[model samples]
Target: MKFRRKKSGYAVIEILLAAAVFVTIGTSIVYLLIDSGYSNLQGRDRVLAANFAQSGLEATRNIRDSGFDKLTIGNHGLALQNGSWAFSGESDIDQSGRFSRQIQISAISADRLLVTSNVNRIAGISRPLNITFSTYLNNWNKTTLLPPSWNTPQIVGIGSTGETTGNRNPFGIFVLGNYAYLVADQPSSTGSEFFIFDISNPQTPTLTGKVLTGKRVYSVFVSGNYAFLTTQAQGSTRPELVVVDISNPATPTIVSRTSFNGNNYAKDIVVVGNYAYITTLNSNSREFIIVNVTDPVHPVTTPVGSLELGSNVNALNINGNYAYLATANDSGEIRIINISNPAVPTLVKTYNNPGLADATEVLFSNDKLFLSTLTNSGTNPNFVILSLNPSDLSIAVIGQTQLAGNINGIALDEAGNQVFTATSLSSQEFVLLDITNQAAPVIKSSLNLIGAAVAINYNGSYAFMAVNDLIQQLFIIGQGQ
Candidate 1:
């Protein structure tokens, strides 16, 4: 017991062996942790690559949906322009710059295309990491337009009238699909300012629904499931832009109203995608207003500042990224404002009416402005065509026509060879003219109405007219010989 003698060589060797085993276990754990971390990183990279590849394919599909002509046979990157997808560059990189994506479009047929999306790691730890997807796209854009018809116009149906007061004057008329929406100044018997009619049967446009939007609804522009309207401001703080949900033709609901504080009231409105460009009767203050209607329920105003037009704006039309304004300015009856940069709208050009008359209604087609002016010299070219010079953005009046009464509303056929306009005259208020020869357009047909046709629209086959008459507020015109 006293002699804890010198340990055996085997015991010393056993101790060293135990230490070696512990060291080996510790080293194994360290390597395991490192490998686990690298595995997680690789998994994350693969997920991101897959997501990027999927996005590339989706964007290509969007381009095809918009216009198949854009999908050419080449590798392309994507750029979002005016809330639309467009091809740009050769390849696109991820936000972190760690990955690159390319969309390859190949022509499969005249109406069909092959899209191949490829994504790969371009930076950081890369030992061959790639993701790919492919899809076929078809032109689905084969649209058969409404056939051309210059037949005599007929008042096929009469719907929407006031049950209480004398008359609810119709201010705006829009025909979309099988429905025609009319916004009026005075509320009808149902205390409604918005009326919806079923035009599937143009012969008998049945009054389908009505929404009471107070009074003095001045203008309306329908898009998809909603109708954008401009109303006379009830109070200085009252919103002038009203959004109505017409998802249900039998029952329309007023979802939202936006006020950009443009002027006394919103005079006209034009919606392009998610934004709504509005003008007011403010000659002294900011008249051009922009509203972000992306969220149709809760619209945000002044997102892209406002512009002072220096004149009372009567009507507004947006084509591409430009906004055409019909103003009361004697010198600048037509104001062409560039809206490509929505944040700051600049006046590109202005045109004076032939008789220096104020513009009442305006439309643009093929770089030409189809305009109607206020009362000038009796029958002194109230309606004129203003041509635009692309290089310098200059304006020129090429052709003109006149009516006994002021032309209040205008419409154009699909081919752009025919134009339909309504006047304040009690008789021959609806007139159609052939514009094949731009220098001098000839009237094709004219129809007499019960009262002054204040608002009018054409849909290839039939012409719709909204008159100021009390008995027949809506006159559905049909094609006749």
Candidate 2:
């Protein structure tokens, strides 16, 4: 104690520095809170505006329910007339005076009317927000066949069913008319893993209904009144194939679920007729499972057989008696399965090349087969076009070209002349490749995105993409974009 060193200024300096750091961190946290508060306020209003637009549409529906003549072609406002909903002025302002709503009606035919509802945030708000909902109304009593298909939006990812931020991300999407069914990649504690949306408009999709299913869903295929989901088994009790009844898009319920014998991840699914073909991640165990879905309510049968592909199958496409699987095998990139016998599926052939290895998506259109693959840094073919002989199912590569990054998904127009792809590139993830001339393909158009585009759907005029971003999970890519 007597030999203790003199007090050093360094200790005091260190204490002062520590105090400064604490102050800085506290100040940063305070600023972040303030900024987030403002952001949430704007976000909450957008949700409200979406609800407002939906209300306007439903009100029109109510009017239609009363009488078809009420849906006259014109821009009309909504009001309560004689205790019944009716069209009024050009636009209606909310009581809060924060939003304005307008309805536009047009005749598609004598029995059908295209109804659009538009909502916008009024003045006084720092940021402007607008929402739109469009749907085709039909005189159901007068129709004999199924209702005509609905309008396809240019860009749609997520929209209003009062959706909130949660531990979820977009994984699968299927569009039916103005409706889009979305499946998330993670389980929601709130039990909303499956979601349905109204995509009659762009950018802002409308949420209609949602339900809970698997702990992790990889892909979704909608056929008839059922939504077939490829989900990962959380445990022995959890299932790999979960089927939900979406007869009423507003309310979906899980009717049946099936689990495989081995531990695996169910990746992609494609429903054809009475069979639901699902692929799993690469392993010794079954990588391809075929379940008889004739009875969607009770889909799985005892001893449901599966095939081992030995390689990872990222995606699958069905054509007639064949199932094309895009795989990541060194010896074979595309595995053609003869599904003529669903219970006993056999591998027909495997296609692979020097530069093309990890195949991600396979698309069949006309007499052509398109493959989107992950590429290397240099010249590695990623977009491949092949000529297929449907009779014999022979494959011959017509041409291929190197792309910047891994191609996540591909969709073709009705004409099959243009090809659309979502890539993993941070920028230019959405690309349009001209395959009009199969011998040579060139990039026609591309839209820069901040994150990777995971999945995509196209209806000639519009491309609905499910991106990897939480804030903008789904969006529209107009033909013009």
Candidate 3:
């Protein structure tokens, strides 16, 4: 039996061949699994970068819509998360104008891996929301307007020892000579009120006069001896523009009035050399109304230019012979119009912002146009500035900053060498900025205001603002304590 178990065995070559085949198959499987896993990881990183960018955009929009006005010139960071995923954003800038770049960095992560995004916010349209329109004439709060013995520490700065009321709203402000005028679109359930203050002294302000308007005075502009006002009418029958003669200062008389159709709404006014530029829009189009007011009583609509837009115009600014207008839509855009020849004006340039931007206001100074924008893409909102080439109508990025709240309007104190931004939501504080170097702006102060400010203006030494509230008051802003 032992001898029968002899040799019918396989050769060494056969055993070697089996071993080679097994090794080849195992190696192919290992390579396939590793390559597939790497490809998937790369795909996930790209998605994270995109999402981080979007988060920044959204946060900006939400702050703006909620009425927080803390935007300024500095790096602002925000973070967002969902489930095990998280996103973060940071924004910064240097210089201004068309070439100025605002770099926004966003970080996204899942588990131990991280991804990022860099975005640049361009120029566009922004306007204030939840405006306070009222009619009152005291430089005090509700207690000062008519009543309970007021006993709050006197506020130092601007024109007067007191402001009309504690609540700020009216959404409009104008400065002429040493005097500042504020409009309260809503006042004690009556109507809008115009409060005048002598801001000759930046540290100690004084109240001058007050006028009660039958309607909400949405906008106000001062030129020479008159302060032109526009009211938000409830219907077509109400006149929009209510020209007030401020020659006497104490008594503001309505010299003339103008009305528009129910569909068209009058939002803002700018008084230039001898003309008044007004912005009006509806669901159809946004148009500029050029009115010849050499004779204030006989105001004539010299020329009206219509603009075609993807959305409505939110705010407008005029510097010299150019009109800088901000509009909102899927993409925010800034349109520059040459108003040298008002009758036959032309569009010189246009800039589209990178994300959803609702430009509340456009301000031009030091050859730059600052945009107060709101977005819903990130956690913290943004305040953007662009360089302007008035000659070619080219807009470049000059500088940008970010903030914690929604920014509505900005004011520049050239003499104080500072910039002030009004926030509408959360902490209603006037975020102060140092613009010693226009290219590199920074935060220097954060003065607290009483209400939601819709518009702000500065006359080198003093700051003027309008807020949203029942007792809409005009505030004489000073440096923060």
The candidate scoring highest on TM-score is: 2
Q: Name the lDDT of candidate 3.
A: 0.58
Candidate 1 vs. true structure, TM-score: 0.66
Off by over 4 Å in 1: 1-151, 188-190, 234-236, 414-416
For each predicted model, how many residue pairs clash, with residues at least 3 apart or on different chains?
0, 6, 69
Model 1, residue 349: C-alpha shift (Å)? 0.5
**TM-score per model over all chains:** 0.66, 0.67, 0.60
- Candidate 2 residue-wise lDDT, 118-198, digit = tens: 999996457888888776688877856543222221332444223354445677777677777777766345556677877
Q: Write the per-residue lDDT of candidate 1 for residues 288-393, one digit (tens) a residue.
A: 8887899888988554757887888999889887899999888888888888888888888887776767788889888888998766785568888778877787
Assess the local accuracy of residue 224 in candidate 1 as a C-alpha lDDT between 0 and 100: 82
lDDT of each residue in 1-481, candidate 3, tens digit only: 3565644465676788899999999999999998766654443333333334445444544433343232222345553345322223344322332111222322221111111224332322111111111111121212223232111212344332122332235667777787778775444444336777776774545667776667667678888777888776624477667788888776777787766443456677888877777776545644556777787786763334444454556678898888887666545457777888877667777776665656667778878877776543564235667887656667777666666666777876655656677776555456776767756667765655656667778665446666553322556654321
lDDT of 1 at 411: 88
In angstroms, the error of model 3 at 185 is 1.7
Q: lDDT of each model, Cα atoms only?
A: 0.80, 0.78, 0.58
Off by over 4 Å in 2: 1-166, 202-204, 414-416
Error of 1 at 106 (Å): 68
Model 3 worst lDDT window (10 residues)? 128-137
